[model samples]
Target: MLHGIDLRLPRGRWTAVVGPNGAGKTTLLKALAHLLPHEGSVRLLGREAAAWRPRERARALAWLGQAEAGAEDLLARDVVMLGRLPHQDWLGVPSPADHAAVDAAMSETQCQAWRDRALGQLSGGERQRVLLARALAVGAPLLLMDEPLAHLDPPHQADWIALVRRHVARGGTAVSVLHEISLALQADDVLVLQAGRLLHHGPSRDPATHRALEAVFDHRIAVHAVGSQFVALPQLQLGSDSNSLATSPSED
Candidate 1:
């Protein structure tokens, strides 16, 4: 349902896609990953995403969706090994490089401890970490993630941010759909969508970006700087007279 949405995500940067529910944030990510058909063009690595060969696209970009369903019987390590499919030969044997990539990805995601465990046996958060590891194992220059923070606790969320930061530092690109405003603000740039259209796209620190965010949410949320970081808090609309304000309405 996206219309006239034209934007370029720079390389070596982390861009977060954010908006209210049903704003087409997930749709935008899917479009970028070529999972959905659209009228306009989506270029990745100097070529149209739709024009790339399937195996070539897989090697150039990795996708992690919100709910990734797979065989429950597979071990965590084996699941991660799937990311290396594009690089493997017809025999599909795991090369030393593939093993190293999987090990590094699992270690970075803090899921190495559960490498031998079955996916069905892992907790939701643990499964999320393993999926993240699988995405990382792809070793793609561009990573597109939708709601990657789902089922993650605070510490693990921070770890995810760190991982993305490191990836960008190494000249990789990351585009993610995140509901957590504070976490989204940590990214280098922000793309705000509203009702399947582009509302704003700019650096996270720009005042205009914050204003657009507030406007889209009906000003019920306020972005504030907590020390060096910006945090989004619910705006309290209460009467001036304390006694008159018996109840306060909160917006999400």
Candidate 2:
């Protein structure tokens, strides 16, 4: 449902795609990953996305999807191993490098404690950490994630931010479709979308970026400086008799 969209994401930088419900943020992400049929051109690492072989493209780009299915029966560690399939040969056994990468990823995500457990046996947050570890184990130069913080608590959410920061600092690129506007503001840049169109794309700290963010949500939210960092907070306040403000449910 996207229209007239053309953008060259910044190399080696983090950009968070954000918008209200049905703004096409997830659709745009899937299109960039070449996971959806689209009419526009998408370039990856100076080459057309369609030009690369499937395995080669998988090696270059890692994707973590929202509400992805059918991993419940796999053990936690085995689920992470799926990321190494692109680098492994057909019917090949896990190599030492693969083992090391998996270990490191698990350690980074703090999910090594339950490596033996099935995905369905873990809590939502634990499963998310394992999935994130799987994505990281791919060792790809570009990472795309959708709603990565869905089940994470605040502390782990901070950890995820630091993890992405480390990834970008190591010369990799990151793109995430984030629902948490405050968390999205932490990215280096922000791409604001509304009604399947681009409203603005710029540095997260830019005044114009803040304005576009506010506008997309109908000014129900406001960007404010809180202790030297930009944060998006709710502008709508409930009356003294009201329990809380009502909000419409969000969707892709």
Candidate 3:
């Protein structure tokens, strides 16, 4: 149901897609990853993504979906090592390079201590990090993450942002669908969606981007400049009832 939803994510940068629920944010990511059927063309690294083999596409761009699950009995590090499968032949054992990549991914994600833990036993946040580590282990130049920060604490969320920055610094590209406008502001670019349409797509610094975001949500949300940071906050939309303050507890 997306319309005119073209996006260009520059290499060595992070782009955050933000929007209300059911705005086709996840659908857009799926389409770009060739996980879902869509009408328009989707290109990765200057070639049509659909033309690539499954293993080739998986190698070129690793996607960390919002609700990902792996074998419950598998160890965390083993799961991360699974990312290297595309580079190996069927029934191939883990090579030294695979081990090195898995170790690096675990260290980067601070999951080294849980390397031997079963995936099913980890907490939600821990599992989320483990999945991200798996994605990182693939060593793909392009990464797509949907709601990657969900269930993460503030510190881990910050760490994830720093990790993304490091990845981009190494000539990688990342596209993430995020709900937190404040955290998303840290990305180099932003794509705002509304009603399955591309409301705006450009640098995060653009005032028009903020305006489109505010307008798309019908001003029920307000975008304000707090120092150098742009924050989107829920604003009360008052009804005609004089006895009620329009704001709900959640809005406040």
Candidate 4:
């Protein structure tokens, strides 16, 4: 349902999609991926996204969606091997290149240690990392993820950021829908949506971007600077009386 939206995401960078619930963030990604029908045009790498053949598109973009489901009996390595399907023939034979890519991706995501573990036996965070490895194994120029931090703890979330940074640094592009405002702020650019409309799109540090983000949230949240990074905090509402127990100075 998004409208009046026009964005040209840069290559070799990260663009984070942020918005309140029902803001159509996921819809936007689906549209860009050609998974949904939309009126407007979506161009990837200078060509219409829909113009590419399905297998060609699959080779060009890697996707990691929220709540990825897989067979519980499958081992982690087998799941990761699925990312190489685009390069495989109809029989899905793994080539030497595919094996190397999977190996590297597993090592990068730190999933190699559990490569033989059944996906059902892994913890949520562990499973998340394995899924991320699968996405990375695709070796596509662009990667799209929805709520990729779903089951990751704080440290692993940070690790995810670092992994994406490394990817972009190596000339890869990443677009992700992130609920964590602080993590979103780490992206090179931010696309803020509100109720199916494009509210703002700009560098994350731009003052205008911060203002639009605050306004979209109805001023209930405030963006602050902690050292070099930005943090979003809940705006505390104080009583007009100015002497409420919550606000009153406490005696030792």
lDDT values, one for every candidate: 0.91, 0.92, 0.88, 0.89
**TM-score, cand. 1 vs. native:** 0.94
TM-score of 4: 0.93
lDDT of 1: 0.91
Ranked candidates (TM-score, high to low): 2, 1, 4, 3
Give the per-residue lDDT of model 3 (tens digit) for 1-252: 688877777788899998877788999999989999889799898899889999999898999998787899999988999899998989999999999999999999999999999999999999999999999999999999999998899999999999999999999999999978878878899898888998899888788888877776677777788998888787875678866557522210
Best of the candidates, TM-score = 2
How much is the lDDT of residue 71 in candidate 1? 85
Query: What lDDT tens digits, residue by residue, belong to model 4 across residues 109-183?
Result: 888999999999999999999999999999999999999998899988988999999999999999999988878
> In model 3, which regions exceed 4 Å deviation?
236-252
The per-residue C-alpha lDDT of model 4 at residue 162 equals 95
Cα RMSD of all models vs. native, in order, equals 2.4, 2.0, 2.4, 4.8
Each model's TM-score? 0.94, 0.95, 0.93, 0.93
User: Which lDDT tens digits does candidate 2 get at residues 38-87?
Assistant: 99799999999999999999999999999777468899999999999999
User: Where does model 1 exceed 4 Å of error?
Assistant: 238-252
Clashes of each: 0, 0, 0, 0
State the lDDT at 126 in candidate 1. 97
